[model samples]
Target chain A: MSVRFWRVRALAMLLALFVGGCTAPPLLTAVLGPPLKPLPVAGRLRRPVYKPYHEETMTYNLVPPPKADWHAKLKALPLTAAGGTDWVKALNENLIKPKPGLDAKAEDEPVMDLDVVLTPKDAPDFKVTYPHKPHTQILSCDNCHTGIFQMQAGADPITMEKIFAGEYCGRCHGPVAFDPASACPRCHTAMPQ
Target chain B: MRQAALWLALLVLATLLPAAQVSAEQGDIVFTRSSKEEGADYPPATFPHYVHRMQFKCYVCHDAIFKMKAGADKVSMDAIDKGKFCGTCHNATIAFGPTFESCQRCHK
Candidate 1:
């Protein structure tokens, strides 16, 4: 065959491959007639399918690696029996220092030393002692009082069901602070004899 | 000569632009309306503009909550307790209310 005929054959093959792959059915059908069923390839004729570019995944090098003695100070800080960071214990021991407000320049807010004893009507046995000292240390009075809870005792009905539903104490307790589900004895100090 | 004058005008405008932006950063507002006339029991309430600015945006309290002009809106302890003026946020619900216990918080 002539070079011109070979060139035309190659061009037709390329066009057929493109039309078969593309979703332009109108053009494909008009040029090549109705679509023909694909023929099955035998074992030897089949080619293995794979991505062309298979280089190893790149490492995130933007963030600098920690020092050799990294986490040494963190390990030195107080930890619970379960091997978790004891936040309250660490705060008391001066292991960690947390600012009450976001702004460093702002003056330290006062901590209400009052402790509220909550006796749920449903579960009278499990009495909860809500200590304002720890809460007020980080948050303002308005953060809870009148918003999440009422200042007056018995005004707000606090139940475990409500707390688990992310209401009242559950707002910070479950999401940010310790999960109340696991730490039951933490809040419920007064157990029935 | 005209180009030189235009350049000088542009330089002046550039300097004034920064000053105009910094004007929004107002100092702490000391409310004296309650304690000014009479020798009141408590001192004037000092509203920390910088502290509130850190938490909220300008539009949160400006125009809608409080007028921009000084002493334009009447602020009284009674009104505050009733959830008006400063009471809107300081009603013990939103923020620490202006109660007898928390007097020094704002008064200072």
Candidate 2:
């Protein structure tokens, strides 16, 4: 064989090893538990490298955990770890407290206990039960009231198109809270057969 | 003697400068002067500066919507109902309206 052919063969072997190293981890780990110790190559023909699955990547944030046991604290809360963070749940559970103002001692307005049930004319199955408890817990009544929604039921024409466009519920849903685009059951809890 | 006079002028300007500039840290403001008889009888609306500041930036209400000075803006129930001053937001839509039932929410 020519010198060029020998060089190409060596390069192909290196490429094969690189690809095998990247793809062989999960298959190897399943068959055998994580590698216990590094292999010592005294007279080995080829060396094999094993990659360990990083447990840290599964954590919510890459930032270092606080000195306190935050794992226990977060685990206690009703957070949708698989889904996005449900801020409303955190507020409801008192896991996180929002001050009415900059003053740590400032009093917040009383929570208005009201639930508006909206049965969209088009899709009554996806009836939306808009709870005031979560909203009034942090925001003042004036925040929405007659501006975005009227006090009377069936007053405002709410549509999915409008919400996705960043109007009405879309104003805060996508920007601040869990995205409504992905999470439909959050609002449309009244699904009937 | 000239230096003393100049110092007096400077002192007066210092006090008056803030009135014009409108400090954001002027905590709560109570509206008292009302032209209507019913307005005078009702408790003055206590505007919680800290509460609003948390929700909105200073520019949301300052200078354009409301003059920063205490007495600069003549805020009354009528003016508010007409969509001026507090009425701009408190029109039973944006914020809680300055309604008959909601008088205590702010006045308190």
Candidate 3:
């Protein structure tokens, strides 16, 4: 065989080894079977609380032992009158002890509220009220200052398109903060007819 | 044959550079102090390292404000109020103070 042929064969084998090493596990699982035990009948049961047949129901009790109840105990504590789960209140009451000077100020305390009216030229009807007080309560001025919005007014070219695309207000609104879709009145309080 | 091997090595290095750059640019890191103590009155404090990193460099707290090792520094609310831990920056003037209302911001 020519030297060129031997070189090509060696290269092909090396490439095959690399690719096979990367993809072997999934391929092996498909050929054989997953090493995991069959899921419990309770897990396999369909939603809407349907009762399974004798064979299906037999494995229901075979489900893994319950996890520690510490999470449940924490959830049971009454933190707020609102009834829904408030992780902050739970953490405060159960986990976090009040430290001197770390106490949050009263809501009625004299705090500056910079409620800016954002009226886009394209959509003059929808005016967004940018509430600064609530945001400033948790975030530093530099969080948004200079990075997202300039300190000067009329400097930020904020558009709905840019916001939806995860720019400007979209940073917190869509993900961890608030639901941007349904929470219209939260921002757009002033709607022109 | 030698030329082919050289080209392969160059290709591998080229792929690694962009991946390294992406991770460096991401900069977002969440620090949780759950390991030190569990089931406290509050959830473990979750420090948004990325949020701070955007304005400040890593060295600002890596060794100066906070120790490099996890669970090394004992941080309390009192410590923060005395301008020790988070209070150094979150003193209302520099950043939002560690007030009662702002407890959830970090506790979560």
lDDT digits (tens) for residues A39-64 of candidate 3: 22222222223122235564423442
The ten-residue window of minimal lDDT in model 3 chain A covers A44-53
Superposed by TM-score, candidate 1 places the C-alpha of residue A187 at a distance from the truth, in angstroms, of: 1.6
Which scores better on DockQ, 1 or 3?
Answer: 3
Q: Give the TM-score (vs. native) of candidate 1.
A: 0.39
Q: Choose the strongest candidate by TM-score.
A: 2
Cα deviation of B8, candidate 2, in Å: 81
- DockQ (CA atoms), all models: 0.01, 0.01, 0.04
Give one digit per residue, the lDDT tens place, for model 2 in B17-98: 2112222222467777554443345456777654554354344554557754566787766577678988777664455555
Q: iRMS for all predictions?
A: 32.2, 33.7, 18.1
After superposing candidate 3, which stretches have Cα over 4 Å from the reference? A1-111, B1-108
lDDT scores of the candidates, listed in order: 0.57, 0.59, 0.52
lDDT of residue B6 for candidate 2: 51
Error of model 3, residue A4, in angstroms: 64
List runs of model 1 lying over 4 Å from the truth. Answer: A1-76, A81-83, A101-104, B1-108
Error of 2 at A186 (Å): 1.6
Q: Comparing candidate 2 with candidate 3, which one achieves the higher TM-score? A: 2
